[model samples]
Target: MISSVLPTYNRAPLAFVKGAGSWLETADGTRYLDLGAGIAVNALGHAAPVLVEALTEQAHKVWHVSNLYQIPEQQKLADALVEKTFADTVFFTNSGTEACELAVKMARKYWYEKGAPERVEIITFRGAFHGRSSAAIAAAGSEKMVKGFGPVLPGFVHVDWLDLEAVKAAVSEKTCAIMLEPVQGEGGIRPAPDAFLTALKQISDETGTLLIFDEVQCGMGRTGRLFAHEWSGVTPDIMMVAKGIGGGFPLGAVLATEAAAAGMTAGTHGSTYGGNPLGCAVGAKVMEIVAEPEFLAAVNAKGGFLRQRLEGLVAAHPEIFEEVRGVGLMLGLKCRLAPGELVAAGYAERLLTVAAADNVLRILPALTITEEEMAEAVSRLDAAATALETHLA
Candidate 1:
């Protein structure tokens, strides 16, 4: 017997009736300290006042006018993105998957407009999770992602992670661009080495191949910077951003340099609900608060403090945790056992976490988490570890 809704996701039994700050409460009042932050979407935390105000205010004024007309809120978000990023132009979407689709189109179109239509292939790296879209799965080139979805989209070449020589050899006359995540969220919060990014940028410059960064999970102040790539001192020619950008609202964008976006003229791409007043208003508010230098510095400070605490946790529970990986608030704890074991243990302790590939548990708390909250979260994690050890013994 199938349920009313699709059973695609193996959802947790618990359901939250309300959320405040970093805490979510069930209907029966069981509260959980949320470290996943709705899978890193709620940057400012659950039910943030600023985002709420922005959403409701715009809801009262206007909602969807579509891309056929000029939208002030959309223009404001675009301007903010352009000012804060290397992108000269922006195209809004409803989710990161949509952004991936646009990024693929923009990359291939760039070559087509440059009279190099044959240069359609894009070089991607292993352990990269772009999205569930056909193009994104093809770019990942993973059997788990592309299996059963027969006849996968073509023109993507995969290589080993951080193998500069592999990337160098993979690039040919047919290569259009190289795409990767600065910090892979689903692939286990893997942060690329800064040196590797620098080398990739050099390769792009030499080969005229565009560098595309999927910052959907690591951008919008999650990495203690505006974006994760900033830490590498290398900017992407085309960037995909989402998640925290809208402070829990459905919003994503494809940011591109003028040269890269030249091919996407009028009618080349668009969306009906993208850049709607409601989403853009919330996104603008989120950007206003997150783009502050002081806010980002605080994130770095908290990230360091949290990492220090996590290192102690890993030391205390060598039987459970392997090591800690990642940067800023986007941290992951490699588990000695399957990460799902820790995830289920966290649930028993009323702690929320997300499990990923490579046997890692993602800890993506709100950027605005207080020091006291961090302590509590860690305490709960310790309790969960103890419980796991006892249950196993």
Candidate 2:
């Protein structure tokens, strides 16, 4: 039967009707342990009571109010973000893609306001996924993403990942910003070396170019920190955040220092549904929970446990897994077998995982996942690997 939805994604065969904590259920009551966590969006797990209460209370009071009027909820969320991070100002958006768009615009406008409009080229690294929008796609400049899109947008310079020499050669008076993900999620759970990130910050400072960090997948407690860059002790001039920041709702934000955001005057940018009262109310509650010292410490401890278990898995199944990499809950199993095959096997074993480039299987569990659930997930993964080995034999 034909479906009304666009076939943009090669979706799985299963459809879940409900979820709670780290588990999901089908209509017939089959349960699956969800390590994917909707690709790291459900940081607090499914149907979190606090998030539900926040949304319900906000829904009863107000759903949305235009930007023309003062929205207290919006102001509160922005204040929380500013107080916790390096940014002094924030612009809300409906998704990470929209935040990326505005970040690019803000970078270029900064240069334009300085009477150097030619300083519009943004330097990006290879194997990066910004978004599908025209500006974001052009900034990424990946052949696979930009192939079908007509004439690529200009003013973006693409370089190999971690090639410091290449980045040095790419930057010039025309370079508006140096943008890259601190942890490349879609590119196989790669974390930029801390030294390299620090070097980039130095270069940006010396050249007077803005630095942008896309923390869409690795931020908001996914990496055991409020933001991934916090581990490096380096900050960006502009940062894009989403995913877990909303708990489960659709919300994103572009954060910038007052100096970097100077070009954004009144009427320069706007989103009708970006900072609605409902989303902000829920987002504020998410911030309150994820920013606590005790909660973050728990995340770090769980990450260590998960990493140790994964190391054991790699050692036991050398024929199936080559290595285990990544930080915190955003771990990846670099598979000797095809990642898609492992993902399908996991489905058969009633465990959910996501695949990434470089033949890696992502294990992005919710921050609140219990120790018992983690053990069960590992047991299922072990079964899946054993099944694959036997089938191949």
Query: What TM-score would every model get versus the actual structure?
Result: 0.99, 0.99
* Candidate 1: tens digits of C-alpha lDDT, residues 31-58: 9999999999999999999888889899
* Candidate 1 whole-model C-alpha lDDT, 0 to 1: 0.95
Model 1 quality (TM-score): 0.99
Model 2 C-alpha lDDT per residue in residues 141-189, reported as the tens digit of each score: 8888899897999989999999999999999989999999999998899
Give the C-alpha miss distance for residue 379 in model 1, angstroms.
0.9
User: All models: lDDT?
Assistant: 0.95, 0.94
lDDT of 1 at 152: 91
